[model samples]
Target: MSTIYDVAKEAGCAPSSVSKFITKHGYVSNKLGNKITAAMAKLDYHYNGLARNLSTKTNNRIGVIVPFLDHPYFQGLVNAIILEASKISKEVVILPTAYNANREQQYLQELEHNMVSSLIITSHSLPYTKIYPYQRFGKIVFCENSNHQQTRCVFNNRKEIFEKLFTTLKQKEITNFGFMFIRNPQDSKTTKETFEAFKKIFNHYPQPERIIYNCRTAEDGKNGYLKLKRTIPNLQIVLSESDISAAGAYQARGNSDTLIIGQGNQLVSKLLRFTSIDQHLDETGILALKLATEATSTMKEKVNFDIIWR
Candidate 1:
């Protein structure tokens, strides 16, 4: 491989001059700089990013940790973060962990190693206690509602929104409810809060008939509908974690009076003509990136949500 020495020799200058021009650390005459640039182009030289980052103690890259990219909610979040990052000439590295704690820890290790400047955790399986130790590496921001004192969090009032949804259903005279969630019990704070809110509102109903757990995809939603139909014969309302799942349930029900409410007002929800919670996930993504870059005091920023009634 052609080295800086080769480029310097080709440009008829010293290696220090070539290094100064490439790293922009010191002054190099325009004439010599042009020669070095021409020589580098002739040799098809590429700068070693790892070596540069190691020497500078910085990188123009941000690491985002998400559960998965298949869901529209996550896609929207990632896209917004990427868009915002691009405006500042930064790049995002998405690390999908599929709710694996060990994989999340691996990404934390990457942060510690200075592979990226900071980390935006959209969703993580690791507990806050385990993740807190890594703050020494770089800025770690949570994109979900959290009470952790170690990191800044940007999230919506999901519990309040769920209460509003339940109240809306009650006002519509709908009692028999079926709730679909993406995460397992105790796996996520949102899931736990949502279920608790559901229980609080529907305390009179049987627990088994009211929940459809692990509804991560559209297929799961369809199958969950089938199970709910067989079990809860008089089911009047269905709420799903994502619009994709709600679309599946809407397909299974096929033009019924059953009220379907979807979380994440995605395109599928609009096409399916169902009411959905617009959590402004794009805004969440932007805020997450901002917090990760700005390094504010450990704080929580709550974004409002709206019900996109069809």
Candidate 2:
């Protein structure tokens, strides 16, 4: 209920002085500033953020649009972004789309309406062309590899990591392999890069039947493992895009000889003692926020990955 005018009245100072103190737009004497601060504390007064944003055409909130919040990879990125944003007094708004194009488009309206200062899209259902048009409203940063050259992005270096993984498998002479994906590689540039790298290292694409789709949980992994066993019969190795799913695959191996490689290098991977890829997601999140807040050009930064052999 207390406004700047009330604070001014309580402090016996001009309203302009209180306004300057709140906005830090003009100089206010330290002595008067103390009085204004004390008055605000006594009255429990808070500035109207919306009003300020309307006047300045700026917001202190950043929107992060992701497909799934529960996934460990995205969870890490969201947590990192939230922590880093807090240090700079910025608020992070999580927008989960569930890979719904309509929901993703609705979230984009926040940028159009200036509700958020910028958006960091970790994943999406719509293509880059549709998302690219919204950048004119505010800065749009992609956390995955995007085909748009004009959009800013910060992503993990997945291609190099995939090459290293396949090379290691080849060194072991493991030819019959399979892949597990959280989403279809056909729709995801990052996962597509993994397949491209695999093809380059290996002589052929992975068997269509060997690759599993929609593997999010351990149960999905278990089912995927069963399917792979039925189809490949002699599957040498299986690479899962997430550690949770990989853990499931490991459990379902049931004394089988298939080597399981997981992604995310999360707790499940470490506890289970399996090789996993550390995508350096925390760094990607920090860099993505940095680009969303600071970058003016079409900047693309790639965070490195490490293959943690357990």
Candidate 3:
């Protein structure tokens, strides 16, 4: 409950002196500064962040809008961003967009209107057009894909993930394969990357069959599994976009014995004993938060994703 005013009074100095010291804008005598510090400690005074941000033109908070926080990939990313952002004394606000492009754009506008320090967006359904609003605010936007020249981006090497998975799986003596995913571009950096690798590996004669499905909702994976069941009955190998799809495939087959693989490594993937390629999403988030901070504080251009598995 203690405010800066109380500290200023206790220190026998005016509140303006306290404000200057807090913002590091103007100079206060070292002796008076020590007194103010002592008073602050004694009164347990907490600076009003809103007021401070208003005066200093910095929010000290990062706005993060992600589609589907319940998924392992996003949860890992958020967790990583939180941990890294905490180290720098920054807070992260996560708004669930549920892969809705419109809501993602709306939230970006909201963050700008509120003068949040920066933003880290995790989206699958949103395109570059939706991110145009950030231009009006002059805020930094670090989206997925470190390769793309879109001011700011972060994404793993998608093709390398696929190649690694395929090469590793091939070493395990599993050649017959199937790929399951939605025809959406706003998926994962690795999703597209791995798909491309798969395409390259199977571009020869007798390519493996691929089953594509339309994503109905964030929680929709059953249809993908059903589609797989009908297309490639008794399939020995399959690569799925997420844990849900992998679990669905396992259930549809009525066993966990299938060699179904998944990306992002969610709980369902582990529970079903499915093989998976870990994307280190938590690390992705941490790097993203760090990049966003650098972008804001230093006005940097982009922060790239580190390909651990790839």
Candidate 4:
């Protein structure tokens, strides 16, 4: 009936210190080590290995909640998180919420309620407010708001991508152009930054109003392309926020005469011969794992990931 909590109190040490001794996880002073051992024996404690480890030490469970796993972007990031977590001493429990607030909330609740030790959340549908309650329970983090000292923001720089993209456009002397992007919420930090960069370079030129489209599914590529076609019917040159969006535009209208550049070098972008920026999926995921390890291993401060675009 005695839990680690009971043993820790009896040992006159924090639960984490007791956990370190039990799991042989890290260095423990001779005094603390002896205290923990004595507490365990007195309490007749039996380490069920995995169970107690889950509830006591690392919890061995890391939560990953992404917007839409169906998107190659998220899929790649998840792969990195999984691979990195695998290399360490913990296990990952991924919860793909498909950008649903209710779903995101449910996953967060379930992780805490079920005693998941740490969580790395990438919420595209749900805002950060949903996870505010998790600030104290453990290491609750965001993958897109690194500005705050406590909340981790994992992302890449769009300035470099934008700079290269604009240079290409300028070389071709394409004075008039339009930006193809979705509405807000779809407006990620990179998206907004990219738009800002675009305006800086092209605002002076007489270009048409920004062509925005909303996509419902990966299949929305067709619908998105149709919308773009209807507007610029001959929409020759445009910069799209996502690979699928650019591919959709290509699907509705082939890239024969169009210079449609896509961000996020997804497979479709390659197949469609659309130029795109590689957000470094493997690197991003690896960094995410590094953040989780540091946060879980030491719940001190939010980690900062220096993002670069290639």
The order of the candidates by lDDT, greatest first, is 2, 1, 4, 3
Clashing pairs in 4: 143-154, 146-153
Best model per TM-score: 1
lDDT of 1 by residue, 248-296 (tens): 9998987667888898888888887899999898789888888888746
Model 3, residue 45: distance off in Å is 14
Model 4, 165: alpha-carbon shift in Å? 2.1
**How many Å off is the CA of 9 in candidate 1?**
3.1
**Residue 159 displacement (Å), model 4:** 3.7
Worst 10 residues of 4 by lDDT: 301-310
Q: Estimate each model's TM-score.
A: 0.93, 0.87, 0.69, 0.69
lDDT of 4 by residue, 28-93 (tens): 999999998999999998767767654654466888887666656677778878888888867888
How many clashing residue pairs are found in candidate 1? 0
Steric clash count of candidate 2: 0
Model 1 residue 82 distance off true place after TM-score fit, in angstroms? 0.6
lDDT of 4 at 21: 90
lDDT of 3 by residue, 1-310 (tens): 8888898999999999998887787999999999999999999887876866765566777888877765566677788888888888887887788778788777777666655777787665666666755755545455455333445556555566566667676677777666666543336554456656765765642233455545322344556656655676565676677666666666666653557767666666666666766667766676677667774443233333222221
Mark the 10 consecutive residues where model 3 has the least summed lDDT: 301-310
lDDT of 3 at 133: 52
Please give the CA lDDT of all the candidate structures. 0.85, 0.88, 0.66, 0.66
Kindly indicate the candidate among 2 and 4 with the higher TM-score.
2
C-alpha RMSD between model 2 and the true structure: 2.7
